[model samples]
Target: MDSLTQTIYECLFGAEYYEVNPASDDNTKAADVLRALFSANEGGEHLKKSVHDIVGERGWTENLAKAILGGIENALKQGAQMGKTMADASEKAIAEAVGFARDHPYFCALIAVGVLAILMPWVLEALGFAELGPVEGSFAAWWQSTYRGYVTKDSLFAFFQRLGMVWH
Candidate 1:
């Protein structure tokens, strides 16, 4: 078996077990070690303890430990770079959207009005101002009747009077 696999076997199963077994094939040894680690009762706890022992007993050299740490640091740096790239892309998209809206105020206003018109009935129903009941004819006829009922000259005058009061 390889030195790393031998060390792992010794760490998990003890030196006696490693010497007694002496597996010729590295793959078979590794699989056997995996089976022993997972199939045992309290396997997770055993695995944790074995890993602690392996580190504490200096199963790996200083250079090997440093290499593992370097790999982790590199992975973290790459993740941070990826996050920065995504943030920059999102900022660019938002800036473009704002620029478009600023350059086409009339178009934006028309779009807003269209959206409001489509949502008016649902808004009115939600506010307990009207019910979306069965219509006699088309949707346009129903909307016209509903609009006339709520938007009379008296209501318009009342609204303007309230606005004037607010301004004053």
Candidate 2:
């Protein structure tokens, strides 16, 4: 049976591919360590054992395994560091987007009121079948209609009517 570490490592990085050249001092084994870190199934003990098995299977003497373990450790360590960087970048992007929206108050207000206008039908229904007039030319009504038209091909009036609250 394969060692648990080997199993976990394979689960993580088995999909990675690298070309090896027999004549050169290629460090492709780092690929295995990285894959192990990225795998969802890995655990600490399993990873340590897997590294031992991998180096052992590669026919590295004890001295060589000790030497190569340093490089392997560095590779997996860097992969984790890179993952942190990517997550930080994503968080920063969302923060910037929110800041931009806040800085553009008029655009944000327009969106908020438009959403409110969209919900007006439900508001009226809750107020007990109030006789709301036709939205043929009023500014709020016209804006909603034009906006809905541009977005959904349904006239704003028609969209509100489908909510069973707003009239034409």
**On residues 65-162, what C-alpha lDDT tens digit does candidate 2 reach at each position?**
43345444444444444344334554587799799888997666556645755666455334232245334454435545556545454544334334
lDDT of each: 0.46, 0.46
Best by TM-score: 2
State the lDDT of candidate 1 residue by residue for 1-168, as single tens digits: 789977755544445445755563432334343343334444357656754553455455543344334333333344422334334554587799899999998667656644643555343233222223322464433544666656554543233223323331
Measured against the true structure, the TM-scores of the candidates, in listed sequence, are 0.25, 0.26
Instruction: Point out the worst 10-residue segment of candidate 1 by lDDT.
Output: 159-168
**In model 2, which runs have C-alpha deviations exceeding 4 angstroms?**
1-82, 117-120, 123-168
**At residue 104, what lDDT does model 2 achieve?**
91
Per-residue error (Å), model 2, residue 5: 22
